[model samples]
Target chain A: MADDIKPRLRVPTTAKKGEVIEVKTLITHPMENGQRKDAAGNVISRQIVNALKVTYNDKPVVNVKLDTAVAANPFMSFFVKVEESGTLKFTWTDDDKNSWTAESKIEVA
Target chain B: MNTLLTRRTALAAIASVIATRSALATPEQAKEWLAAQAKGTPTEGKITLKAPEIAENGNAVPITVSVESEMTEKSYVKAIYIAADGNPNPPVATYEFTPLAGKAEVQLRVRLAQTEKLIVVAEMNDGTLYTASREIKVTIGGCGG
Candidate 1:
């Protein structure tokens, strides 16, 4: 019932060759520590997005570890030098062993 | 005798009220929280994330990210994600962009709770995830407060 784990990406739908571009990505998650107590004093189970992998045109680009302290809806921004048209792949994993993926296309004219 | 009984009743009522509220948590409270904070689209390989080796302040620290792409219509950079490890909430911020955003780069201030690795994920126009991280040391407590 929790479909909130969807991946959100901020990408330019278009671009030009030799032009630098900015991109960002985020995911919906609670990053529960398994330490918080419910009103009934029961400890809440831990739930967090733990791993991330990024690829360009199916090539390895970046990989990261999502730790326990990351805030909810983890966000990141950066630049990429585009030489040719290609695809970007972003994947995030949660503690429940669920993984979500998103992609964007660049034209590089 | 009546005064003592009335005081006891008031205390019991207050306790019961607190207990009830705690038990009545909405089924989707956590999910709702996540949705409200969600940002950007996820991409895989068009960007780079750069962070500091050490963070002096747990409350506020600086971070930076860069990407490799051409800004033309055919090829360009897209978005970036910044997340701090060990923070109470973690998902820091998601930055959106367009091809007009020349030089895919962003610098920001963030809050960290303790010493841990910070992750930065970038998404290009074609849908990919590029990532990087650095270990930052937090001297003061930020998350517990």
Candidate 2:
């Protein structure tokens, strides 16, 4: 794991069968647009998260496409309905061909 | 006699011209942006967008959107759209959510080209529309100043 890259998420370990849970995620990564110029006037080259995918218990939940407009250390918060106890998987991919994945488990009450 | 007539006409024409110019300038180019957003008829009380008054950094400004709902199978927030008035491309981001997703809320960091009003529009499952806007002042050339 890249020390600079941290995935922050909110997931309750336990939930009711039909309970609805809110999930928030923020990743600590420098989303370089690659269009910016350095002190030497050279293009920084885009290093942004191109895509983010989230799955719950091997079931696809949310898929996102990130762009240059996404700021550094991107933060995204949303909701998920918990039908059963399972694992939530989050993955983010960058332009430099790097993929970061994190998983959190939830238990149904 | 002709000189007097010319002078009077000149004065009247200049006055009328100045009056028209002032009338046109009264509506700043910025205010027109807001009117242009609600060009169509939308249902009432559908969306609420909340943002800070001043952003220290133009690069990363936090934005949040919330829709009033129960997140039920029959009623929920369908989609949320965000736009910045003065940015080069106003459409900042678009999010789509389903009933399986309980509450309709999204918090994210966005880049503002400059200080401008950020608008958020939420489309509910029932086809109603609610909108809210907030102005964000972005300090130029700074890191979360």
Candidate 3:
């Protein structure tokens, strides 16, 4: 498993019913593209967070496929409509099959 | 005077074509990439891509893509693709959306190696594709910087 992998999310604590809100996410990752060499001139193994999926209230909101070109600490911001109070789930999967998840809740008033 | 004006207009048209061809990915390359991703034929329009014209740091260049859509059960943006012409891996990211998602807009940060044209293609639920592109200049390298 990757070390020190952490998922971060920014979501509003409250929202109006049926309102569109912005959500931002970030994850700490090295995102090794397999093109780098060490001091001894050996190619580092490729390890990247290749996919990210987000769900709101158990319904899919967004699914992202990332490539080697993505930089370290992947960050994404997107919009979602809130119909009721629920939790937003975020999952990030890497090339090594390691995955991390985080969740946030919002209240609709 | 009329003949001179016509000749100048023709010259301008040819110059513009050359400029675009040099800056953008070859049609064949774009087609092959799109086809590999299983995206059907993409027509140009409806996709709006916003990125910095000049990025001081290539490590985290912000980008946003929005598609015209009505986010209904019958109609919505199915997916959105972001690609770079000069990156080692041209395809940067793909965002898939459903009607339940409500909107067809996304913003993310990407690493660009150098000055290159960024392409955004949005696939509609109806299987139609809309595309847009922009050029971004990077002064610092993402990997090393």
- Index of the highest-TM-score prediction: 3
Per-residue lDDT tens digits for candidate 3, residues A1-109, read 4668889899998999988899989999988877678888888888899999999998998999998767789988888889999999999999978899999999999
> Candidate 2, residue B95: CA error in Å?
1.7
Q: Give candidate 1 regions above 4 Å deviation.
A: B1-145
Query: Each candidate's DockQ score against the native complex?
Result: 0.10, 0.28, 0.45
At residue A88, give the lDDT of candidate 3.
91
Q: State in Å the error of residue A108, model 3.
A: 1.5
Cα lDDT for residue B128, candidate 2: 67
In angstroms, give how far residue A69 of model 2 lies from its true place.
3.0
lDDT of 2 by residue, B1-145 (tens): 9999999999999999667544432223333433353343455465667677888777878777888887766987766666666554455566666676777877788887666777766667776667777878887622121
In order, candidate lDDTs are 0.63, 0.71, 0.83
lDDT of 1 by residue, B26-102 (tens): 32432233334344434355455556667666654666666776665666555566665555455655555565455
Scanning candidate 2 chain B in windows of ten residues, the lowest lDDT window is: B24-33
Rank by TM-score (best first): 3, 2, 1
